[model samples]
Target: MSTVVVTGGTGTAGRAVVNALVAAHHDVVVTSRSTSSVHGRVRTVRLDYGSPADLEAAFHGPDAVVHCATSFTGVRGGETELGRRVLAGARRVGCGHVVSISIVGIDRIPLPYYRAKLATEKLVENSGVPWTILRATQFHELVTRLLSGLTRPPLVLVPDIPVQPVAAEEVGARLAALAAARPAGRVPDLGGPEITTLPALARSYVAAIGRRRRVRAVRLFGSVFAGYHAGHHLAPGDATGTITYQDHLDAWVRTRR
Candidate 1:
């Protein structure tokens, strides 16, 4: 089995990827800022992009590296710097293949986060290491969290935008498979099983939690929201994900019971 290193292994998508790689019997090494919170049979390492030694150690001697690390809450150049360090480390270790996870419509979306993701994708393309970039739509959990936070008392205000939210586990599995295969520059974008409106998603989340909240659709006046509302962020013909939003809510409700 190939030695595979997964960055950001403690995060939602990264954790699922690590589990899948371990199940496949690949020599999997996971990295995080701290290993104290990491569980399971996988090996864990501390990763800090600011420290070149840490980056070099994390990517050392890996046949393949799955880069899932991203910092959305940090400074403006955090994501770009992280991507650079990952590529540099992979190059240092002579990694054969590098698989990266990105968002669908990052090129079309004008939001700063999407722009940063797109910039990172560009880095992988020119990193000289064989790479596969998988661009997926929003995750069901992210949508649920966003809606939950927007639920102010009795009214849940949701932006009127179309979204195709995929399951993180499904995306993780896809990433693991890609990491095992030959690098294919950019694969077909993965999307949810169905196209849904944000308001519909909010209502489903409210009903799942047994919250008596009124869902109201709001038109957000911004370039970012306009792009989303125009369906630029959706993958209509590329709905590869089988799990629907309702399925996500049902599973979540079962977990809470």
Candidate 2:
């Protein structure tokens, strides 16, 4: 069996990828700073990208590496550093393929986070390691988290951010498939079924949770503008996912209930 190493395996998308790989009969090794949050049949290792030694040790004997680890809230400098460390470790261990998860419209959105993601993509391409990059749209869980508390009080200030919500499960499946295939420069974008707005999403979430909160759509110009002006940071054309936002909401509600 081929061994697959997944970075950030404790996270939402990373965990899903680990699950998918294990279910497909692949040997999965998960690495992250914190292993307490991860649960499954796969092996777990303690890792910190800050330490190249730890990273090298994790990469040892892995057939492929799924690079889902990211520090999205920071500027580009730190991400660049971490990307370099990851590439070095991958090379040291002679990993066959590296599959990276990135965001759509990173070129169009000039935010620090997107800039870092774009730079990492370039770094991966130039690392001399065969690689496949997948740029996916926003996750429905991320959107729901952002809108969770917005429906409080008298008025809810909703930014006009355009978003095409994607199910994390679909993205996870695609990532696993990419890891199992030959390296492609960049894969097609993955997005949800329909285009949606921030306010509409907030209302749907409030209803889903059976909350009696009222959400008023108030237009605001914030960092969301940078994310919104590019059409909600969504990929163009029809890259429809099998799961819908409503479907995601129903699932989340069922779990909570």
Candidate 3:
């Protein structure tokens, strides 16, 4: 079994990747800023991405590294610096393969987070390490989280744009599988089984939670929203995931009970 290290293994996608790796019987080690309760039999280490020493220590002796860590806001060039540090540490320890999880159509999206992801991708490509980049569309849980935050009592405001939401578990499984195999650079993008609108997703979320909120579609004025509306973030040719948005909602509602 190969030893694999997953950064940000406590977060949604990271946790799913860790679980899949453990189930595959690989020696898995997860790193985060702080210790948390992990589900499976795996090792957790404290890793501060800003500290090169800590990053190298965490990356030591790993056969492969699946990079799932990302800053949500991508402010102050933090994400780019983190990516550089990860590459540096991986190179210092002579890690074989570095698999990076990126977002779909990040190159087409002009948002701050998407820009940061693109920068990270460039870093991995030039890091001189054998690397594989798997770009996936937005996750279902992210859509639900966005909708939940916009639920203002009687009205649920949603952006008027299209999205293809994939399951984090599926993305994680794909990352794990890639980590085990030979490094293939820039694989096919993964997306949801169907293309859906934001308003429909919000309505489904409201119905799932049994809320009486009126889902309203609002036209957001921004380049980011324009890109989303233009379907730049979709993978029409690469809808590889099988989970539907309704399936995600059903599972989410069941968890709340």
Q: What is each predicted model's overall lDDT from 0 to 1?
A: 0.87, 0.83, 0.90
Q: Which rank order by lDDT, best down to worst?
A: 3, 1, 2
Looking at model 1, the pairs that clash are none
lDDT of 3 at 158: 82
TM-score of 1: 0.95
lDDT of 1 by residue, 79-114 (tens): 877898889989987899999999988888787778
Backbone steric clashes in candidate 1, count: 0
What's the TM for model 3?
0.95
User: Global CA lDDT of candidate 2, please?
Assistant: 0.83
Candidate 1 ranges beyond 4 A from true positions: 36-41, 73-76
| Per-residue error (Å), model 1, residue 48 | 1.8
- The number of clashing residue pairs in model 3 is 0
Answer with 2 or 3, whichever has the higher lDDT: 3
- Comparing 1 with 3 on lDDT, the higher-scoring candidate is 3
Residue 39 in model 2: lDDT = 48
Residue 38, model 1: lDDT of: 37
